[model samples]
Target: MVLRRIFPAMYTAKDSEPANSKNGTLYLLRCVFFMGVRKPPKRYFLAYCLWSFALNLCSTFYQPIGFMTGYVIHLSEFSPGEFLTSLQVAFNAWSCSTKVLIVWYLVNRFDDANEILDEMDKRITQDSERKRIHEACSLSNRIFFFFMSVYMMYATNTFLSAIFIGRPPYQNYYPFLDWRSSKWHLALQAGLEYFAMCGACFQDVCVDCYPVNYILVLRAHMQIFAERLRQLGSDPHESEEERYEKLVQCIQDHKTILRFCDSLRPVISGTIFVQFLVVGLVLGFTLINIVMFANLGSAIAALSFMSAVLLETTPFCILCNYLTEDCNQLADALFESNWIDYSKRYKNALRHFLHNLQQPITFMAMNVFTISVGTNISVTKFSFSVFTLVKQMNIAEKLSKTEEEVENLY
Candidate 1:
């Protein structure tokens, strides 16, 4: 009975959802058989993931290529403000490139990613703990739903802008190609752009939400683990041998949890770090754009972009930070165990367990940046510093140009 309680049934239904995570984040893979799991027979879901990946890859190149082409062909006619606007789009494309990389990472590492869910399903067997896990997923799903909703709306806005408003978001992406010569060709390109748009929308949604969900799920498991620690040795009817077995089981549980973390670190490190770098640079550009553009429209747009960025990035930062707090509380939870009343051997085993808990499980990105609010906070500080340096250089460059003109006049 104790063994049953400790290890799960080891059987997963053939048609169970790919991400038994119960979170809306990997909604992209919900279509058909993905990685290894079978789902509803609609293969379009997988097709869409592929479709989005391809178009996003094209767009990832289109943005910078178009911008650079303009600089080369129209260098004499280039306006700094126009270049800035295009540069912003180029940066946005750079973001798409990173997203593409993340999507590729997630798809390539799908099984390892699923282990997180498997671990949760295996360990969270008790009814009360299952309820708590469900609650945590519900909360996380709501937050991610909000994030997805905002992004989808943004995509909808872009769609409307391109189709109805006659303003393509990535205008001139096909420079030197005349779309006006043939209405049929123009319409065809528009349709293809729409396809690409769907790809990007799906890609961004998956990349942004899953890492945060992974952190939240890990946090929930840690909470349950802590509760288990606090309950150790509390049963009066169980024999001494039973208590020893349970303690051994608890040690195994801790080891499994750490292994889950190890699996997760590789899965998310690239995604989250790439995400942080992209968002940080865009945030920096947006900040500088606000000061550089005194026009009311530009200001409002910059503020809106900044808000969308924070909405997307903030949850990952906050939740991952909470994971650290959960780890910190494990030692206390072990102390809450009724170890004082146990035999010396049991007490000694618990002592070793407590010592292992001292190091704590922290999610580090590329094993460099500690994945937490502190790391995110540093990204923002770095953004601000870059913003300052850019502004100073712009001012100094203008001053130097003026001085040269004055010397020429003299």
Candidate 2:
């Protein structure tokens, strides 16, 4: 009886092995080749561009509506009055449009450059490993473009629409639709912002980690070239001059890799600077403006949560800059480390790191904000679960200070 009960499990495993083994190997091979699987097709590229353009067009049309509506409404309604309200509306529209344009243009340029790099790298036929690197670069660029395009477009569109469309902003004036504390609107806002957070986190992961992987590949190439040089020198028939020439060529390739590292520095630094400055100014201004009219406590809670997110993300952005700089310096020193017998091990370690690269750090980061959805909150007081969660954890003190400074401005 026991054997009969166990028979199905045994047979299931027996029957599954051939198919599972073949499929698993195939899947592993694809992952080994591409590092990450291929992204959606090229048609998605054109669709993304068009979607951004459409979003910009929509925002531009509605800017006038927000301005006109705020103007027609009496000045006394808003705490700062009508002129200030209209100005904030117009400014928000302009700020949002600018953000969309900036994100769109930067992401587009990175996509083009990464694709070119991948093609160039693909031509290096030392082994399957080289091909895998190129394919990974290509796939990562595609994924980055997809995430950023979706994030910037949707965020800009939602923000613009909320601020400008009809009475939402004029009535709520929440800068964002803060429905998490509102029973009627909680579910919808949660779904939307959760998507937004996912995209944002994914973009951050790609921008931060892609270069690190590429740097690892370059380091590996350096080590391999060093080995080849040693082998050439050891050969009984090889000429000293030939060995020197190979060494020179290897050094040149190393320099080329360094140049790629240098190129990424400005991209990383500029992204951090521009994103922080723009988000900081816009968010600070919006929160202060909102507090002037709405429930001050609710505004405080909402703005505090926003600042927490902005601050927590700041470290990742700064780390991107740090990695870019560190990689350049490290790439230079890695060649020198050969004398100490550390170069080979270092290179091997980097390879292992690259092998485990796509481990969902981005998805995990999004959980900071995502899982807060539908948690216990005070609907009457308009406090959010996000605020409670972060407060309990005591994150983002600098962000809290900045929020206070901005709030004081109002």
Candidate 3:
């Protein structure tokens, strides 16, 4: 519902036929602009970049950092169960903070990516292709957000529990304010944390959605681009000269697509690497919570939280997997083209193009590993391994402590 203005889940035929798809992009940018996540307009003669930094901290990076300040500092004092909670929160903090830091430092690269996307959008001349891209983007948004909303339901538990239990979400240290001194102070603090939570979730969603959404749009463009490749020299009405011109245009568009990929490499590589690094531990802790927590609410939270994490992280791999496949399909597409009778120049260009596509266009995570669905399985296996080790250690500790108690009694 929140993103309906930008990308409607259910739109009629006429509704999809806008003057341009740039409106949705504009609407999203306006929302992110107000949040100070996106770079401010150049028209603002003296815009302070610090506002974006401040907003990033408050919106996404602060709460977990705040919670950890108390729990993490005195880590040796907490029991295993207590420490697990802190660890879970810490892993999450690392993920969110790293992404926030990336945004703060790399906002301009992000702007480049967005502008390139709009340029790519303008290249889609056919109404049918535009509608197809529109529907694909809309479907991607709906699926992404539906899981996100479910996870938000899980996150809402923190706020709900705060309201019912009359305590803030975290028992973290706040050096600036004595928020726990009185009911009013506590109430005010809770209100602020709630505000922070809403803002943080929204910004984090946008941060993630930006690159992924742009890439998804690029992927859609390539899908059309591939079909266009297959249609080369098919129109006999056009002379050989005309068909050759069309091939040149196709090659130019392909280069634009490649430039888009080059721009996106910087935008996604580091983000994906850090995200992959955390998934193992985060999933391990949450899986442990589901297995160990006797409380129904805690178990549900753990389960839902695990589901949300998977929803949030896994689809990137899945999407990249599909995108990789789409890119490879271009080779076959060009080969299948009716270029048998085309000019020598067209065949030479097509041959070079097919050769480039021959080496499958796979994106890597920080140049470390290929982003694909296989990574998802590997992550899951690593998480289960961590869960097993942690589980056995916890059980062994309980048994050893029990024996010590018996010995003392004896």
Candidate 4:
């Protein structure tokens, strides 16, 4: 109920309901851009296509233009700190574009995603321990939304700092090389950047949140299923046949959850892979820039960028870890169930279910790397290593210059 209150459109079963029935950042986006149209209207589709094209084009060219102009053309004048900062910004923009592309690919499957959510809701609400499940879902939603709010504040601060405090007049901080000759032109460019950035952020948050919500719901259902399995033989009045029937039902439920996870994987896998890749570079570059740049504005920008990257990557890893753990525990839960008292046929079925559970049910990033807390740790370590290497090179370069000056003085 609390989940429904917080995310009515997300939790609601009816697709026909007006998008305005729910009110939240993500729900509003859905209402305006994605909801109710199995096939988006031609105008809407064209608008989305054009917007995505512009965003991707900016992401694609921003880095190369900056590299050529700042590093190649003016190599002697380019400070290492400035170069790293530019690189970080470019990577951040590219990451945002990747998020947009992922959402674009997945948007058409919004109805299927909703059906999974609706199924999960129906199953949980009908469970015997519905209250506990509801509480868990509520807590999860609260934590998620709280993180999202914090991220929004951080993004806003960074955006404002970049606009008013960091850049010179007529020189926009966006990756573009174009000159805005007038205040109004600069304002318009900034506005467009804001719009594109917000759209990218919205898409990333919604895409990540949907899978997380589904994982939480599936976890609740699995818990209930395990409990039901354990209670199968507790009721002495129930006949063996009835118990066996319940066992079959539990098996069916387990299969359904697995099926749901399978369906959800493809929608998120490539996005997750790209996120991991981009975040690694972003984190490393941000760290290098933060350490090298002593100015307040640069520090704030780097910190903000780092926070955004961590917020995006950390929760997804945590949720994936939980999802994996919940799935792996299924076998143990089944074994704990009162299966000994059931007939041979029922035990056989239980054994088969347990066998199936032994195969890992995990979310993969592009089917290459598994999404887990372990992977997050590895990525952090790698990023840190990169930062350390860069720092050492910087120190060595300064030391070499100092030695040359000392020799000249002698």
CA lDDT scores, all candidates in order: 0.61, 0.38, 0.66, 0.60
Error of 1 at 3 (Å): 41
Q: What TM-score would every model get versus the actual structure?
A: 0.76, 0.40, 0.83, 0.77
Q: Each prediction's Cα RMSD?
A: 8.1, 14.9, 4.3, 6.1
Off by over 4 Å in 1: 1-28, 31-57, 60-64, 74-82, 105-108, 155-167, 179-198, 294-301, 393-410
Give a tens-digit lDDT track for model 4, residues 1-410.
79666674333233332222112224423532642223446767877766545654543334334334444554443345555665675566566556556665666554554465455555443424655455445545555565566556555655676576434211224444333466665666656555545544454555556555556556666777666666666788889898888778777777777777776677678667777787777888888767765268667766866776787667778877776677677777778777776688888888887888777678888878888888877877777888788777786367446556756776
> For candidate 2, what's the RMSD?
14.9
**Considering summed lDDT, which 10 consecutive residues are worst modelled in model 3?**
19-28
Winner by lDDT: 3
Model 4 is weakest, by summed lDDT over 10 consecutive residues, at 16-25
Instruction: Summarize candidate 2's per-residue lDDT along 60-153 as a digit string, tens digits.
Output: 3344354455455533333342233334335444443344334334543444334434433532545433433334333333433433444454
Best by TM-score: 3
Q: For each candidate, how many residue pairs have backbone atoms clashing (under 3 Å)?
A: 1, 0, 1, 0
Q: Residues 1-410, candidate 3: write the lDDT tens digits.
A: 56555555433234346424333344345546756755466876246466665666665667777767867554444444434544675576667667766765666775676666677776677777787677656655555566457656666765665456466554445665555578877777767766666666655565566555666667778888888889888887999788888878887887777777777676577777777788888888877755664146545556666776675567777788787788788888989989887678878977887887777666788888787889877876788998899777787367447556756776
| Model 3 C-alpha lDDT versus the unseen true structure | 0.66
